[model samples]
Target: MTPSEYEHEPIRGLPGDLPPGERILWQGGPEWRTFARSALHTRWVGLYFAAMAVLALLSGSMGGLLAAAASAAAVTGLLSLFAVLVARTTVYTITNRRVVLRVGVALQKCINLPLAVIGSAELRPLTGGHGDIVLVPNAVHRLGYAMLWPHARPLKIGRPQPMLRALPDAVNVAEVLARACGAIAPIAREDAPAIRPAALPAQGVAA
Candidate 1:
């Protein structure tokens, strides 16, 4: 469904108040919410744990199996725990004025882009291995990052183009952004922007 068709609701966990002269245009959690059903990492982790559990149950060397399972379980548990922490800590906040992408557990890394400075937004979904949204700027900039997630749409405004990843409803987030920016329509793209191999930065880590 389009953002226009969906009702506007305050984010369940956020405060309702906004500073004077500022208004929230759009706010969303991770795209993982919507695409959880299809997340391969999640599936892989689940399968690993399930297999270990079954091995522990059926093996004659139950003690050894239990120890092995425990080690695997510890690692998997830590990975899942970190994922949840990252998802909870990361936030995408858009206002009439600018877009903010913040990531952190304690200390934070924030990338902000003003709507007025944006040339355009390109939405490209990754194909094959795992679906992802890649946002590119019309001009070269520092935020030329391609974010991977189950359901997210990359957005480009100005320098330091912030991307939202693993969101539940990324298309909805994009629609809300387009509405806030007063864009007539979303830009549809067949492929991600080609960049020089030397210029590409490190890919963002999956949550």
Candidate 2:
């Protein structure tokens, strides 16, 4: 995953230009440190390794202790690198018409959730104004949890919800989305149908 993968994009986060009357409201990627802690579970991983190291130390073997320390360092380093890649490659876009997740590590993919298809949004607040906003798609839209992975809500494979992970100033972003959705509430209630997977822009399997 590298920045060059997305350098060819016409717009910063979107796959293509927005149609007339549709405009971007807010755009941002995850804060890498917050992402590491929340999505990557770095703290839990470190604690697990620390427990292993302690157990190894209690066994009274110098080799075991060294091995545990090395394993912990290697895993932590890899996770840190992955978190950085996720942050760098991802760009969450909120437009007047939809919320777009520009995600992927090696093969970039875009998930577009039109406001009409969005049933509701939930915010999970975190420290320092960083948080996650999970979007619940209407029952008709079936997004694959595996495809969305870290960008999808954890353990929600049955009904995958696209998440804007570890976003900075997520409250403001959520409010913008609310207002945008509110603007079309009446029209959506009467005529908007969930977008089919085939209709999604730049849809592709991602890891």
Candidate 3:
């Protein structure tokens, strides 16, 4: 899914009340700059537009150059704004029984995934101590990637993994998740590979 699908809201971290026996283990949000760089592909997009603007100028078309400049600025600004909004609004909660994603923009959403339903998971790291955890469910559940945008794993079909996106101290978070996952599910340590930023694949379905 995409961030556009989410509505905006004021982030309040975790809810004041949680279900009984559902103890919170960890809570954090994505870094806006990192989210821009990684999820928003800000550098690549900005560079592409910058190049287009330059090309327009090189072509000696005042109108085209102006248009390109405007287009580039608009796209970059929108993406950056959204990145900031996502960073501000999102709150990832890991509880004893589930992972709760409090995300959305105009419409705030609360997604709860029971630990028992998570078949396996993977961890991908970003620069500056941030990382992501891709939770692959064993059986079919309802939600698709669209609703989990920016927080969902990039490119997987049939069963898209719900990702804990752009988390700080990702490895430690994954460790907490791993311990929790192991407690109720049958999964191998190798299944949840903790990959570094450089090691992460460049290609993805969509951010």
Candidate 4:
């Protein structure tokens, strides 16, 4: 509970009154080891559960091999604790016009997206610098891929494109959201590296 404690506690993801100029250019979250190696691949499922726990310790005389090495160390510690609880309850915002998503671990809310219904955006980086920013809303924006899992866009069909997952630098936060959506869409990619949105760190998801 800190992104300045959702700033004032009304908590509908805090845009109850930001209309005079529409400020808030960026908020941040994710990067729990880049959402556990690109949205819970969890380092290739913990390297295939540590190579099946070293082949169940070389088949240790096999009697179900110590329960298959304790079930591959309990499924690699429950997928690294669900990617550190989805990077500590997730949150990604960028408000010059809109793009909020407070996401859920179980039942959390907030999922606005309005840069005039975002027709296109894509920035996938993912290696160590971490990245993802795939919003493609237009056609009356519906959204629902399990309501944006790990932010979403792994499978595409009709819609479901809201994403901002695992952003560390994320190409400078997608170049500060492509210079705030470049006056209503031209963010075709400008390669970000420097627009320090006040050095981020609104408390949480840093380690």
TM-score of model 4 (CA atoms): 0.38
Better of 3 and 4 by TM-score: 3
Each model's lDDT comes to 0.48, 0.81, 0.73, 0.67
Better of 1 and 4 by lDDT: 4
lDDT of 2 at 188: 64
Global Cα RMSD, each model: 11.1, 7.6, 6.9, 14.3
Ranking by lDDT: 2, 3, 4, 1
Best by lDDT: 2
Candidate 4 lDDT over 138-202, as tens digits, reads 55666678877768888775567878887887777676675676555444333322222333323
Question: Cα lDDT of model 3 overall?
Answer: 0.73
Q: Rank the candidates by TM-score, best first.
A: 2, 3, 1, 4
Model 2 misplaced stretches (Cα beyond 4 Å): 1-6, 190-207
The digit string of per-residue lDDT tens for model 2 on 1-207 reads 555556688998988988999899899999999999999999999999888889888989788888888988999899999999999899999887888999998878888888888876677888898888878787567579988989999988888999999989876776677677767777765544332223221211011
Model 4 misplaced regions, further than 4 Å: 1-4, 15-19, 23-45, 48-54, 57-59, 71-77, 97-122, 125-163, 166-176, 179-181, 184-207
User: Global lDDT for candidate 4?
Assistant: 0.67
The TM-scores of all predictions, comma-separated, are: 0.51, 0.88, 0.78, 0.38
- Scanning candidate 2 in windows of ten residues, the lowest lDDT window is 198-207
